[model samples]
Target: MSMSEAHERRLRRATRILDIPGMIVGKAAAWLIVPMVGALVYEVIARFVFNSPTMWAYDATFMLYGALFMLGAAYTLGLDSHVRADFLFNILSPRWQGIIDGAFTLFLFFPAMYFFTVATFEYAATSWQQGERIPTSPMMPIIYPLKSVMPLTGALLFIQGISELLKSYYSIASNRRFRDEDGHP
Candidate 1:
């Protein structure tokens, strides 16, 4: 194979490998809806039919929803499903698109996610140290577990970003958009 062809194969391999974590984590996070829905349904039945209320249901639903949203971010990114103002972007040539995407990933996405991961790690550390609990609810569910998801989500996004950056570089070198395994650009 030519050098360029070999490099493209390497890039594609890297993309596939990096995509695995987001796929697994994202699918797992999607299942959070089950427990969240269960909590809501139980709350409704308890509050209305039985003429009683549960304190933990609200907290459970809130935390589950938050986890689902945060954890799904990297998964959505892997699918290239994030919304962007792509009117002007779509009109650009593939080389220019790669330039912009790679530049943004290098200069913007990396720095922002780095700070986000650091800050969230510290946030979760403090929460764990204090054994934090939700003060708003009577049951006072432990919040440190939920807080831990923040840093984890950041790390997931960072990993997925590496995949995207590789694709962007491939696009730059080939003067064509790099397609994922599913044939998506």
Candidate 2:
């Protein structure tokens, strides 16, 4: 194989290795929907049929939904499902696309993710230290756990971001589309 091809293979290998944990975490987070839906159903039944409302339901639903949303980000990135202005992007050749994408990933995407990861970690740490709870809730479910998800999500996204960056670099170097795990373009 040519040097560029070997380099591309290595980058692809690295991306695949990094993708595993993000896939697992994202898929696991998807199961949170079951509990979120259950909480909503319970609240509806309790409020309308039983003439009583639940204190925890509102908070539970939002928290669960938020966690679900945040945690699925890395998975979404892996699938390349995040929104992009693909109308113009679709017209570009693979080389030009890779150039733009690699540049953006390096100069913009990585920095943003790094700052987000750092900030969320500090936020979670402070929340944990303070024994924080949802101040608005009567039951006041301990919020540190929910707060903790932020950093976890950030870390996952960062991991996936590295994979994406590598893919971008490989594409730019090879002048071709980076193949998926199944070897699809």
Candidate 3:
């Protein structure tokens, strides 16, 4: 293989390997929907039929919904399903697309993610240390664990970002669409 081809292969391998964790985490997070739906349903029944609203249901649903939304970010990114202006993007040649994507990932995306990850880590850590609970609710579920999801989501996104960076580099270097292990373009 040519040197460029070899480099592309190595990068593709790395991206595929890194994608595994994001896939697992993202798929696992789907299960959160079950509990979220259950909480809402139970709350509806309890408030209307039994005339007694749960203190924890509102808080639980909020946390569950937030967790589901945050936790699925990396997974959505890994699938390349996040919202983008693809109408303009799709018209470019693969090489030009790669160039733009790699530049954006390096100069903009990575820096933002790094800062976000660090900030969230500190936020979660402080919450954990203080044994923080949701202040708005009388039930006041301990919120540190919920706060902890921020860093986890950030880290997962960071990991998938690296994989995306690698794919972008490979596409640029090879002047071709980067395919996965299954050879889908």
Candidate 4:
């Protein structure tokens, strides 16, 4: 293979490797919606039909929703599905786009995610250490498990961010927009 083709293959391999964790976690997290819906429906039926309410449902729904939202971020980012003000961006050349994205990822995205991971890591550790519980309901479900998802989500995003950085590198090197593994731009 030519040097360029070989380099492209390496980049593609790295991206695929980095993408796996996010894809797995994101897909698993998506299943949270099923249980969340079940909890809500159960709560509604219990409260209305039987004049009884559930304490666990409120906590369950919120925790599940939060986990789903956070966990799906890396996958969304991998798919290049995140919201952005891309009106002018869409019109830019691949090299310029790569430069802009690389700069942002290097300067803005990296720092933000780094700090987020650190903070959430500490938060989760403390929660776990304390055996924290959600005080909002008498059921008082242990919240450390839920809190742990924050750092995990951050780590997942950070991993996907590396994949993005690799794509940016490919774009900069090739002077073309990087296509995904499936050949989508």
Candidate 5:
């Protein structure tokens, strides 16, 4: 196989593996919403009817909300659900848009996320070292693994972004949706 063919296969394989994580993240994200809403309801009921609030509810809600937001990001990006400046591009021909997508991802998306992932990893590492937890609610200890999700999501997003970048490049190069040579089209 030619180098491009080999590289394309590699990208597809990686994307397939990455998609498994994306699926898990998506499902986890969906489940988080249930607890987020439930926590709020429980907190309200506790304060009103029982005249006391659960200590951990506040912390749990906060953490759940954070996890929900962070974990859902990559899944959203993978679905192309993100909003962007597509006004001019919408007017352009599809091929031109593909070219622009490739160029923009090369110049902006990858570089920006490279730094974001690195910095988030450092921040999460510090939190882990300190054994950080929610200060306001002690019962809900800061789980270092939880904080680590920030960097993990960032990395996932970076990977998905690269996949989209690859899609854009392939669209321009082959004048088709990014797909294998087997006419998976």
Candidate 6:
């Protein structure tokens, strides 16, 4: 197969795998968010009507919201939907844009993610070992599942960063200059 075909195939695989986290997060959201919302509303009602507050609602919401946001990062990167400045990019050709994009992924994205993964794992492990629990009236037992999301998202980002690097490197190899948006040579 030609490099173009190979690139397309690889991109397709990457795009699909990159979406796994988002799908999982989206599904998890139904269970997590629904209850959290219900609990918050219930807690508010209890506090006002009965003069009693639910201690766990705030913590539950934090975890649910955190999971939703962190798990979506991989999907965001896959779609190239992460925030960027279009102003300067409007001036460059596509291939050049690809090259610059790859450089950033290589030097910045990969290393940063690697460190984040290590740090997250360490913290999660410690929390799990200690059997961490919320220091509140309810004293809910907090586990490491949500804590593990940090490293998992980092890993997804790392995979996506390499995929982007390969696309950029391929572009640079094909021509010193980038093609237009149409991808014509």
Q: What is the overall TM-score of model 3 with all chains considered together?
A: 0.91
Model 2 ranges with Cα > 4 A deviation: 1-6, 179-185
Q: Candidate 4 — which residues are off by over 4 angstroms?
A: 1-3, 180-185
Instruction: Kindly report the root-mean-square deviation of model 1 from the true structure over all alpha carbons.
Output: 2.2
What is the lDDT of every predicted structure here?
A: 0.90, 0.85, 0.84, 0.89, 0.76, 0.69
TM-score of each: 0.92, 0.91, 0.91, 0.92, 0.79, 0.75
| Candidate 3 residue spans exceeding 4 A from truth | 1-6, 179-185
Q: Which ten residues in a row have the lowest lDDT in candidate 5?
A: 176-185
In candidate 6, position 47 carries an lDDT of 94
lDDT of 1 by residue, 53-105 (tens): 99789899999999999999999999888988778887987778889999999
**Consecutive 10-residue window with the lowest summed lDDT within model 3:** 1-10
Off by over 4 Å in 5: 1-18, 136-140, 176-185
TM-score of 6: 0.75
Q: Give the higher-lDDT candidate: 1 or 2.
A: 1
| Collision count for each candidate, in order | 0, 0, 0, 0, 1, 1
Question: What is candidate 6's lDDT per residue for 42-118, written digit by digit as tens?
Answer: 88899999999877777777887787677777656655667889689657765677778888888888889999989
lDDT of 6 at 142: 78
Cα RMSD of all models vs. native, in order, equals 2.2, 2.3, 2.5, 2.4, 4.5, 4.6
- TM-score, candidate 1, is 0.92
